[model samples]
Target: MKISELYVYPIKSLRPTKITEGKLTKLGFRYDRRFMLLKVIPGENENGSGPTLKNMHIPEYPEMGLFQTEIEEAKGESEGDTSRLIVTYNPPSSSDTKDNTESSDSEDSQARRLEIPLEPETATLKPFTVTMHSSPTTGYDMGSRYNDWFSACFGYPVVLAYLGTNTRSVLGTLAPAKRNNESWWRIWKQELVLPSNGHGNKMLNQWLVPFSLGYLVLNAVSWCHGRIENGTSSPAVAIGVTALALTVLWTVVNILVNRRHEARIGFADCAPFLVISQTSVDDVSGRLDGGVEVDLTKFRPNVVVEGAEVAFEEDFWAELAVGSNGNAGAGKDSKVKLLLTGNCVRCQSLNVDFSTGKMGTGEAGSVLKKLMKDRRVDRGARFSPVFGRYSFLGGEGIGERIRVGDEVVVLRKGEEYTVTGKSASEAWNVILTTGY
Candidate 1:
């Protein structure tokens, strides 16, 4: 397959900016999802302490897709002059015939534009914290002027925060906690011990402590029973047995959930790279009622490839290399190599039509519903439909550049097994065993 298109989202949830070439980094493209919008809740604080900054996305606010973004290069050859990120918002024209009397020139005058340096002065910006997918990370506030401009566009209070040198690990990528000058007991309580499933370790620590107390009480009762009648039937004995069983179960569950990897990411959702094929999109369009071709923008894929013989063939791709010539064996020395991690899951945001900046009404808006019938294929993310593949930089291709029309070589192809399936686990055992 050949690389057909490349894009970068300077701001999350906004329209993507197409590019001819892009520099690959640990966090996908050079300027992808480094900035995001957060809703500022007035007279409220998160956890009754810090600033109330809630994440905003296209799913919650469909009109956010209406905003357009562009990157303007620096003109002068000076160290102080940096490239600027330009964002523009054009209000939709009125649909009523009476309200359509406004001239096109007059409507253009109503458009709003905002520009800020792509690389901001981090020393002068204020440090701010915001939560994405329940994980809190640090960012720099872009001041009140930029905040006011975004607030006016949305007709509500919101702020733009930039991820400046702050990193958020992908889920299941955290290294084991180390005892660096910390107390032994503290480490045991926080890291060594396990909590129940679907709950934070710290939040469930309180309950575990009581189980420790039960252990002591059981020891005392056993001693008394041996000294008196040597009987095993006692209320304390029953409670101790139950507590011991539960503690063992919790430990097993924690071990299964705490699997880790070595990948890192920015504001992008699950992985650094999202890859999709043009043939797969064409297949989805054909399934629709009128065979209306849907725009790829709705999927928001960073890389688009063509020449796939079959639709959805990306589901079996494990490793890919981009270079001047498409050769799987030579991918180790290629310009860029990618490790396909998992299937990219879908959400309700796919129903939004960017052309009108609103939720679709006909078959276009019901894309998610149609995919649900047959595309809910990934066992790992069973509830969501699988579209593109999530990937990360691997091999010796870091800091390399990839361009459109580059040759894409598939180094490895996985078996026909869904993610989280037994066969899939066996197929990926090599990568997992090597901790790639």
Candidate 2:
């Protein structure tokens, strides 16, 4: 198997920016969701009276899928630390009514392009806070011009926010639990922080919560040195050597597992990257009304693989490695390593048509129902049908570029490995032990 397609979404919930060669970062694919839209909750604020912000992703507003965005990075660094992001709003017009296609000459003409600075000056802007999943992080208000642009487009009181800092950290459950109890739980120091997307299951949250006693005691020494949050009593747990070691191990595993992808993420729902087999998509499409032709982009995967022998065959891949140009590298430069985190559970977002911005298409639950006939692997999300595996790129090839046609190698196969969601620590062990 090989990578058949690669994509990046510069902004969350908007259109995908397709690219053959992609660079991986600690947060995610470079510029993939560094910016996001938020629904301005009407209330009182610092400006005497203003609105608070809450995340409005594809879940809350499907119309966001209608907007297309392109990032034009400056050719040289001397031009200043900024890039131009062009956003094109695809409004529903009589011309778009004829077909369900995403782009056309008519729509292109009608599409309004809004050019915004990549690195906007936040010196005069107020520090706006928003919650992603459930993690609270601060973002700079992009001014009224941006707010007006998105508000007019999405037909709501929306504000654009940029990730000024890597505020929110990846969930402990998504990545492996840190070893030797070094308090590797949070990246941000907030009073009452929660895991993103309500991943706080009763079992896992007990050990992973930022303020839990187990965490406090493990790094008691660091907290005593005055590492507390906002100068509050809650001290910041100093990251330990064990935590760094685990990270290094995770990176090494990612490099050897699949050299095509490295460990990096930026605001993606679950993991840094998601991979789906093209054959699986073909299977789902074949069953959908025979001629409806549901595009794979609806699934919003970073990487899509073609030529799998059977549908959902990717489930057995524990540690996957992919080589460039069908040529395998000897030490580490040859391939990209990817560690299978868990199965991606589908949500209502899949039902919305990316091209039409309409919901409840005939193909919405049709493919899911067919997949549920046998392909349910995640016991925690048993009611949901899974179509792709959410994975993390290992650290060794952190910024390596991988493209379509990279040869895929399944370095480890774990037929018995499954994400039970009963406990993250237990699940991590299962993923670690079942692989080669």
Candidate 3:
């Protein structure tokens, strides 16, 4: 398969900016999700209190998907290598009636825009705590201007933070605790914190503690209290058990099955790269109603490839070596290898239309339901339907660059076996022996 398109989301949940070429790093594409929005939890003090912010995902606020961002790389000899991040807000202004000139000049039709230097050398980076995916971490606030722009777009109090020093291991990537300990549970979310120097905060030290056991008791009492008081649904016990089991299984599989590779990922979901196929989008479009057009954009994939024989063929691929002109083994210095980490599960976020921020409900043009009918085949993640594959840059290709039209050559294919087990230990053995 050859790459047909490329995309980078400088901020998570925001609209993607298409590019002809992109540099691949351990943290996915360069500039992808390097910045993010965090909704300020109301009525809370953030003074060293581990940042009173709840991360925003597209499903919770579909309007965020309407905001688009583009990168303007510095030009000329004096400008150096810095790139500016330009954001454009799409408002509810358009022209479907007569008087096209008037509609074009109308304020509603005009898009609000702003630009910020992505990696400014002259600016000072102030350290502040923030949360993402329920993981408490530190980031540098991008001043009040960027925060204000996002607040105006979302009509809510929010902040824009750069992932300056935040470090994260993939969810379920670490080995679970063999024994349950209340102390570990109390500080389960502490694993998300970035290691620091001697200087520290008393409030942060009081809250962030070491988590080395059992399940991820992310923020424990505080997290649950906030969610419950805010009228959010309490998590089921099954979800915790499943997550713990999967983490253990994944740890074992990594040790016994694939021990040589190192996994480095950032805030781009489960892995560093997500790949989708044009054939898969075509297949989904055919299944949906005639009026509903299912494009590759809805999936928000980083790399889009073409020439797959059938839909979901990417599931069996274990590794891919990317090279120019669809030739992975063309030369030694020009190849970038990627290891397929796991299958990406679908969620209600896919129901949100990219062009329009509206979302479909229930069975009415629901992409989730259509995917569940035939794509629920991931052994560990049987609860949700699988679509694209999550992967990581591997071997000497950690800093390599891949462009549109590059060939994606599969290196390994996984063995076929059904996961059968009632307990977590049994499931771990099944996963390692069967080679999922």
Which stretches of model 1 miss by more than 4 angstroms?
A: 47-51, 75-81, 97-111, 173-261, 325-330, 418-436
Candidate 1, residues 371-433, lDDT tens digits: the string is 888887877556667788878875345566788888888998878633644433332232221
Among the numbered candidates, top lDDT falls to 1
Per TM-score, the best of the predicted structures is 1
- CA shift of 136, model 3, Å: 4.3
Model 1 pairs in collision: none
| Predictions in order: lDDT | 0.72, 0.64, 0.65
C-alpha TM-scores of all predictions = 0.72, 0.70, 0.69
- With candidate 3 superimposed using the best TM-score fit, by how many Å does residue 110's alpha carbon deviate from the native? 7.6
Candidate 2 achieves a global lDDT of 0.64
Question: What tens digits encode model 3's per-residue C-alpha lDDT throughout 67-128?
Answer: 88898877787553467888888754457745445544456434378787776442476677
Q: How would you encode candidate 2's per-residue C-alpha lDDT over 1-436 as one tens digit per residue?
A: 8889988877778888787878766555677777788887788766766666666667457787789888777877643366778889887666535745678776656546788777667687778666554445677778898889789877778878877654564443565322112242222221123323234474454445444634644555454445444354443233454456446754754444332222223455446777889998887877777587667877888889887899888877767787766455322344367777677666666677666676655666365466667666677656656678777765444566778888777777666635645544333232221110
Question: Which sections of candidate 2 miss by over 4 Å?
Answer: 44-50, 78-82, 95-111, 121-125, 177-266, 326-335, 423-436
TM-score of 2: 0.70
Q: Residue 176 CA error for candidate 3 (Å)?
A: 17
Candidate 3 lDDT score at position 99: 42
